[model samples]
Target: MTLGEILAVAAVGISALTLWDSHQERVRTEEKAVATADRADAEAAVLVLRATPSRDGDRLTLAPLNPEQAIQAQTILFPSALKLPPVETTGDPRIEADWFAEPLKRARKGAGQKDEDPGDQRLPIIVVTHYLAGGARHTSRAIHDLGYTLEGRFLRGSAVTLRGMSIVRTVKEEGAQAALDAVWTGRHRSAG
Candidate 1:
């Protein structure tokens, strides 16, 4: 073939190579995004502590602080396998409570202790999983609500790609009185 024909063939070959590279890059980007999303679905749990200050009885709720609008998944309440220490209602500010005991609970279930003795009295753990607006089964926050308040740190995820925040601490709950008081009076809490 002539030099011109050779140059034309070279140009076509280069264009084809470039297109293939572009396609590979696109595929890699898509894979990265999917992996990131999967990681996000298994995102860390949030710890929330809520209480109602009232004369009747101060009801406290411990749970994961997820989006308020997020829908709740089927909550599974598995009794603690190992004996979790009772809530120490004491003078000291910090009380000892099990922080995120889901894994422990699962391990216990895996073992045949509970199968042998089902009647055993174990403190039930309320595990509530919340789904984000995207409808992905995001996180399963296990709150072992005792008198002790959770203490830890949660680092928020990046702002560019909004995902679940990593809850370093361990809780969520709503006050019954607060809801009722708002519904009835539509005003502030009555000062005692």
Candidate 2:
């Protein structure tokens, strides 16, 4: 073949190879992007699942604090759980009221124990869970009404890529109020 014709054929082959390489690279990039999106969706699903009630019949209760001593204390009664431990406040202050003993008290009183006045043993605890990447300023500010003092926090995760933060606060009277307000206001950051 003529030299010019040969050179032209070689150029055409190189062009074809280049096009094939570009197509393969594009396919790879697309696959990577899809995989990343799928992973993100999965991470969100996991967060939602974590927020669901993992313990059924797990009663949640709160103890009434001394309104005078407790800042922002109100007459509103709070619920508590029987099987759970005393109020645990690490990140912020919290109150523990004996919710599990009411039924027992009634039963005992019915059995003729009138002196069984369930003592007001309430310790305040404020728990905040942050899913995904978010700042803690709002939560910190909201719990202020609940009398919570930021004590400590830690991250919880089932995998390395995704995790949630568990903020435990110790609530005094005002801190408890703020925490209750947060709950009432639905201030917790949602995935949506």
Candidate 3:
């Protein structure tokens, strides 16, 4: 080929190389983004567990000793269904299954203890907290969107029981914990 033709061919080859490199970089960037999202999901879950209360009335807030139930509750409480993203951060996702489940379940057991009279039996309530994953901005947004206007900076989930009546708290973690604690402590007893 002539000198001019060779030069033209070389330019085209160089341009192709540049485009390929750019494409590869884009792919790497996308993958990194996806991995980051997954990490955020896991971290958010852990933070919530850490913030959860250790005791709920008569319930010691024991860990969910049942492996199956603990796993299920972790799924239910963390990575919460709320529209908000994680406020805290984590490298790997881990759940405090036993810590979160045991106490609330224990409180339930305590409430069930046969007492003096039918009217005297009191139910128990349990509250759970989750520290947000991701940055403060993300955590704030998640908390606000989730509707947790509490003093602590975390995600909250709760379940309460009164005799056979049961209620699950989705948005108000602190209030739920307080209410649950009151029942467990006998501060609030139902009139039979």
Candidate 4:
């Protein structure tokens, strides 16, 4: 073939390659944007709940931190070391004395005498909440710390209270049932 013809073909080939590369880059950018949006949506649907101790300090009242994202369903799983069964509820559930009294007693008894820090007496539990936002159901898993301190004038008793609650890393789940199953089976690992 003539030199001019060969040069023309080479230019055309280079132009085609440039167009293909641009198309691939656009596709990648679009995909990334969609993934980011999905992640944001998942986070927005997560419910942050707070635990309040009753007057007697034996029962706990659980409620959502945000009133708008009311809890549709809830489940709480104690640490494997506690060997406690999972608690489930469809409404604002009041945790009776039985649900946590024994555990607190055992934990206080188990506390080492050498340790003087009250923080050492805290217990960790996993809380999974399902809520509806924008007509879609979302599930979130969080870790809450239950704090206990020695109280009383002369009897020297311990009072169980909620220290704080924080959402675990990658808290978003595919669905409510799947998240509950993962937590129950110890498959869900919290980042904090």
Candidate 5:
């Protein structure tokens, strides 16, 4: 081929390569955007779990914080339509499962004491294990401190299988005490 034809061929090859590289970069950028959106969605779901109380006080409520997230979380956390109880959080690390389930004053005094009334409507924790089918372990830990929210109900039931408890990661910017103080002191709620 002549010199001009050779140069034209070379130019075409270079142009094709540049276009291919640009397309690859665009694909990567799109993938990154999708991944970022997924992370944001997961974070929002986690926030709902941390900030809101249950609706029926028996089934987990994602209300008042972000309703759409709460509904989505309910589907994500309990897909089988299992009944999960409401949770009450406290900064006191000493508070475990029993007293939350039943008052200390109601402890059994004599032998052969039966469990408290199930109809009492107290909050029962519904646990989600770290070992899920997919990559949920990563998202779950990102939201909470990676402990069960309720104390003892991790692995006692026939239907439920739990390995560890997960708790909400207290906002360290304000300290653990302040986040909880807002809840009990009613500062988190608006004055209506």
Candidate 6:
């Protein structure tokens, strides 16, 4: 080939190699972003799944649904609005009457006066659970709704029940401690 043709061929080859390198770099960057997002989603899911609450009668306990994950500590904080104390335990904790029964009764009474259904009353409580999984410590916050049923003649007997529970979010150790402090200090604020 002539000198000009040879030079053109070399330029084309260099351009092709540079294009390939740029394409590969873009692909790698995309893959990394996808992997990071997937990891975050998985961690959130783990927090949600591990903070499941189990209730028996007037008692409640939080444990991981998967046996592999074990809870290190758990705290149940009645809303500051409810004016109830926080309970800390490593075992199943009894649902206190003040935590739900009294507030529910009051709500029911208020609803009755307003011509609303007493059965629609609900009390929300925050639960924090600490667990170690995959060599990392995870703290999760779950909001549980407490309901009550009035039974017997004239609805004299009242029993507290667990209406529902949901994992709202996960926090760092410091944030979790701050939440506990907020509740224990009797501050009227959102813990999580």
Top TM-score model: 4
RMSD, each candidate, Å? 18.6, 17.2, 14.6, 8.8, 14.3, 7.2
Residue-pair clashes per prediction, in order, are: 6, 37, 21, 0, 7, 0
Per-residue alpha-carbon lDDT of model 5 for 19-70, expressed as tens digits? Answer: 9999999999999999998876665545324322233222222222334332
Question: What TM-score does structure 1 among the candidates reach?
Answer: 0.40
Model 3's C-alpha root-mean-square deviation from the true structure amounts to: 14.6
TM-score of model 4 relative to the true fold?
0.54
**In model 6, which runs have C-alpha deviations exceeding 4 angstroms?**
1-45, 49-56, 93-99, 107-121, 152-156, 168-192
Q: Where's the lowest-lDDT run of ten residues in candidate 4?
A: 183-192
Model 3 alpha-carbon drift over 4 Å, by segment: 1-4, 45-124, 128-132, 137-192
Error of 1 at 32 (Å): 1.4
Q: What C-alpha lDDT values do all the predictions have?
A: 0.37, 0.34, 0.35, 0.61, 0.34, 0.55
TM for every model, in the order presented, reads 0.40, 0.32, 0.31, 0.54, 0.34, 0.51
Instruction: State the displacement of the C-alpha of residue 121, model 4, in Å, after optimal TM-score superposition.
Output: 4.1
Q: Estimate, for each residue in 51-147, the C-alpha lDDT of model 6 and write its tens digit.
A: 3223533444445665556577777776444445677766553344445566545543543422233564344566677777665677767554444
lDDT of 5 at 50: 36
Error of 3 at 87 (Å): 25
Across 67-127, the per-residue lDDT of candidate 2 in tens digits comes to 2121212122222211233333333232322332343233333444333224321222234
Across 1-192, the per-residue lDDT of candidate 1 in tens digits comes to 999999999999999999999999999999999999876554532324233222321233323344442434424332333333323222211211233243333433455323233222222234444544345445444433232111222473111111111222223345422332232222112210
Q: Give the poorly placed runs of model 4, Cα more than 4 Å off.
A: 1-43, 94-97, 111-121, 152-192
Task: Compute the lDDT of residue 160 as modeled in candidate 3.
Answer: 29
RMSD of 5: 14.3
lDDT agreement of model 6 with the native? 0.55
